[model samples]
Structure formats: C-alpha cells, structure tokens
Target: MKTRKAKEQIVKELKEKFEKASLVILTNFDGMTVAESNKLRRSLKEVGAEYKVVKNTLMRYAYPGTPVEQIKDAFTGPTGIVFAFDDIVAAAKALKEFFEEKDSKLKFKAAVVEGKVADVEMIKQLASLPGREELLGQLAFTLKYPVNAVAWSLDNLFQKLVTVLENVKAEKESA
Candidate 1:
C-alpha cells in the first residue's frame, strides 16, 4: 500500500505530465509480455515519447481539473499511457504500428488531444497522419511548386521568342 504522501507526489507529477503532453493515449496492456512491453517503450522513445503504467485511481486524481478529465472513465484496467511533449501524430503512429506488429492482446482505449477526448477510431486516424517534420516538408514543397512552374514556363516562353526572332533575321538575310 502506498503512503498518502507518496500518492500525493505521484498525482502531482502525473498532473505536470498531463499538462505538458500534446496527446495522452490510454491502453490496456493486459497480456503483453515484458519483452514486448520493452520493445514498445523503445519504439515510443525513438519518437520522443514515453509510456507509463499508472494506477487508475492515481490517474483519475491527476486528471480531475484538466482536459484529460473528459476521459476519466477510460483510466480503468491495467492502463498504460503513451505521451509526447512535441509530436502527437508521431507517438500515435509509433504506438499503432507497434501494436499492429506485436499483435498483442493490448488494446487502445481512448485518447485526449487538443482539449478533446478522441475515440478509438479517431486515435487510429491520428496515427495514420504523417509526422510533424514530414508534414512541414510536404507543405513547403506544395507551396513552392507553383512558383517553380511559373519560372519554368517563363523561361520556355523567352526561349521560344528568341528562336522566332532568329528565324526572322535569317529569313531577311536570305531574302
């Protein structure tokens, strides 16, 4: 049994973590082996995320005044939380892929992101999204494409004009 002071310290730490995290995923890792759990942790770490197993009671206490409180009921049953300080989609994708590959009995319960409680399917959809850097790169490329195309077209048009003028000069000289 935990002492009251220890429980209070845990709740305080959990609250701080909940506040910093962009996304909090609740999962049940009932049947996952130790190796499998370690593998999942490693995968999460690669993307600057961490996973923790917390008591449901402590979680409920920690989330009472935050957006996470919206999904308080989801804190039940062998709960593990995967969270990231920066990229939500990266963490989600990592966890989703890990679950898919391991085929473990663990299941995603719910998630809280951007002040909303996301459903299971929404969590999966979020996971499918590309990471922050990839999305930014795609956006930058998309934004630059039109300018590049216009430049190319203008160069082609200038070349064609030059060609036509040379032909005219040649014809006059020949005439």
Candidate 2:
C-alpha cells in the first residue's frame, strides 16, 4: 500500500495526465494475472498508451475536476486505466484485442475520448476505426485518384487538339 504522501503525489500526477490525455479508458481487471496485465501493458505501449492500475480512491481524488470526471463511476473493482496521449483508435484497438485474446475477467468500464464520454460499446466502435496512419493514407489515395484522372483527361484532350491541328495543316499544305 502507498503512504498518504505517495498517494497524494500519484493523485496529483494522475490529475495532470488526465488533463493532458486524448483519451482515458477505464477497465475492470478483476481476475487478471500479473503476466496478463504485463502483456496488456506491452500491447498498449506499442500503440502509444500507458496502462496503470490505480487505486480507485486515488483515481477519485484525481477525477473531480477533469474530463475523467465523466467516467468516475467506473473507478471501482480492480480498475485499470489506459491513457492514450497519441492515437486513440490504435489504443482502443490494442485494448480490445488484448481483452478478447485474454478471454478472462477483463472488461471495459468506460472512457473519455477527446472530451466525449464513451461507454463500452462506443469504445468498441472506436476500436474498429482505422489507425491515424491508415486513415491518412486512405485520404491521400482518395485525393490523388481524382488529380491523376484530371491529368490523364487533360493529356488526352491536348493530344486530340494537336492531331486535329496537324490534320488541318496537312490539308492547307496540300491546297
């Protein structure tokens, strides 16, 4: 157990991170083993997220004035928090994948994503979204497709105009 001063320090840091995080996922890890928890932490870390098993009391202390307040009720029963400072979708996908792979007592409680309160269902939906890089790549392809089509059409039009001009020049030269 942490001392009173340590707990206060944790709460203060958590509050500051809660303010900065793009998304905070609250989960119930009621029956998760240490190994399983470490695996989950690794998975989350790969996606630019930090996973912490915080005391509910400490979390409560950290929650009141931040976006985490929206999901304060979830801070009960073996609670773990996943903080996504970068890509929320990648973080969500990592959590969801780990949860499904474990098939244990792990369960999502709630989340605050981009200042919006989300339930487990919404979190699952978020997990299904493409990652930031994938979405950006798709957008780039979409934008490039139209530009390439326009360039090709313009090239064809120019070639046809040149051919017509060449034919007219030939006719005038013959006359």
Candidate 3:
C-alpha cells in the first residue's frame, strides 16, 4: 500500500525508463516465485536489461509520448516490463534462454523494439539472432578481412620484389 507521493514517484521512474529503453517487452508474470523472479531479474541485469513489475495504471500514465504507448492493451494482466536500454537482441536472447532453462510461466506478451511492435514469434526470432557483442565481433572481423587481405597481398608482392632483387644482386656479384 504505497502513498500517493510514492506512486507518483514510481510513475516518474517508469516514464524515464520507458523513454530511455530501446526495447520494452511486456511479460505476463503470472506464476513466478520470488526466487524465480529474482533469478530472472539477475539474468536480465547481466545482459544490460531491467525487469520492473510496475502497476498497469502507473504504466499507463507513464506510457504517453513513448513508443510503447501504442500497445497500451499489453499493460493488462500480471504485467512486467523488461527494458533493454542497450541491445534489444541480447535482452530477448537472455529471456528466451531463461524460458528454455526453466519451466517459466512468464509469458511474453509483446515487445516494442525501436518503435516497432514485435509479436511473440518475432521476439523468438530476435532471441535466436546474435547478441550485441557477437554482432560487433562479426562486424569487426568483416571490416578487418579486406584490410588484412590487402596487407598480405602487399607483403607477398614486396617479398617477391626482394627475392628478384637478391637474384639480380647475386648475378652481378658472379659476373
């Protein structure tokens, strides 16, 4: 039983979090135990995501002017919001893995990712996709590949030139 001031503060915090979040996933935490909830929160936190169980009324008030506002109906049920401020895929992947690892009754209602609404299937696809660090590593490798190839080609050409010069010098010495 929170006071009016405390509820207002909660709304303020929700608004700020919603504003900053890149992906806001609405979860139905119907039968989650306290231990399971704590585990979920910790796992989400590990991947730069936050799980908040705010009241639907508070969320509705905070939803205005945010991307998640369009899916207002999702606020219904035992709603919990998973805010992925950094990388959407990583957060989705983390949640999906948790679902697989446990007999999780926490159902994902939907996600507003980058202002686009993603359905349950879409979220699953997102979870299957590579995470932020993995994607970045791939991008770095892709960017470095051509540069490395060119450097290797140049080194090979220089080595050939050096060999030719050495052969010529040896011939001159013999002459």
Candidate 4:
C-alpha cells in the first residue's frame, strides 16, 4: 500500500503526463504477464511512449478539468494507458501491432488523441495511420512531383526546340 504522499505524487505526475501527451491510449491489460507487459513497455519506449497502469480513482483525480475528463469512464477495469509524446501515429501503430501479435490479449478501450475522444474503432483507425516520418516523406514526394514534372516538361520542350533548330540548320545548309 502506498502512503498518501506517494499517491498524491503519482496523481500529480499522471496529470502532468496527461497534459504533455499528444495521444493517450487506454487498454485493458488484465491478463498480461509480467514478460508481456515489459515487452509492451519496451516497444512503446522505442517510439517515445510510456505505458502506465493507473487506478481509476487516481486517473479521475488527475484528469479533472482536462480534456481527458471526457473519457473518464474508460478508466474502469485494469487500465493501462500509453502516453505518446513524440509520434502519436507511431505509438498507435506499435500498440496495434502488439495487439494483433498478442492475439487480442491486450484489449482496446478508448483513447484521447490530440484532445479528441476516440472510440475503439477510432483507435483502430488512428493505429492504421502512417507514422510521422512516413507521412512527411509522402508529403515531400507529393510536393516534389509537380516540380519534377515541370522540369521534365521544360527539358523535353528544350530538346524539341533544339531538334527543330538543327533540322532547319541542316535544311538551310543543304539548300
């Protein structure tokens, strides 16, 4: 049993984390073994995320007056939340892969992503989104495509004009 001071400190920390996190994914890790839990924690860490098992009461106390209060009911059961600070999509994808690989041992609950309350299906959609770098790369490619096409067209036009000029020069020389 934790002392009152310790619990207060924990609640304070949880509140701070909730405020800092861009994505907060709630899961029911009721049947997870220690090894599985550690593995999941490590996986989340690799993507700049951390997982915590919090008491519903503590979560409620910490999340009051915050955007997370919207999903206060989700804190029931054995709640394990992943706080994603760096890349929300990467963390969600990681959790989704873990969920699939574990055969649904880690049950999906609800999530607060970018201050939006996401249901189970919405969480799945969030997980399916491409990672930050992938999305940025795709955007870069998309932005570059028109520029590349224009450059290619200009080169083609220049070549055509050069060919026409050469044909005229040759014709003039022969004449």
- Model 4 residue 129 CA deviation (Å) reads 2.0
TM-score of each: 0.87, 0.87, 0.90, 0.88
Give the Å error, residue 140, model 2. 1.9
What lDDT score is found at residue 24 in candidate 2?
A: 94
**Worst 10 contiguous positions by lDDT, candidate 4:** 102-111
lDDT by residue (49-114, candidate 4, tens digit) is 999998888888899877788888888889998999889888888888898893557988888888
lDDT-superior candidate, 1 or 2? 2
The clash numbers for all candidates, in the given order, read 0, 0, 0, 0
Measured on C-alpha atoms, candidate 1 has an lDDT of 0.88
Judge candidate 4 at residue 122 and give its lDDT.
Answer: 74
lDDT of 3 by residue, 77-125 (tens): 8998899988888899889887777488888787888888889888889
Which residue segments of model 1 deviate by more than 4 Å?
A: 1-7
Between candidates 1 and 4, name the one with more favorable TM-score: 4
Candidate 4 Cα lDDT to native:
0.89
In model 1, what is the error at residue 163, expressed in angstroms? 0.6
Give the clashing pairs for model 2: none
lDDT of candidate 2?
A: 0.90
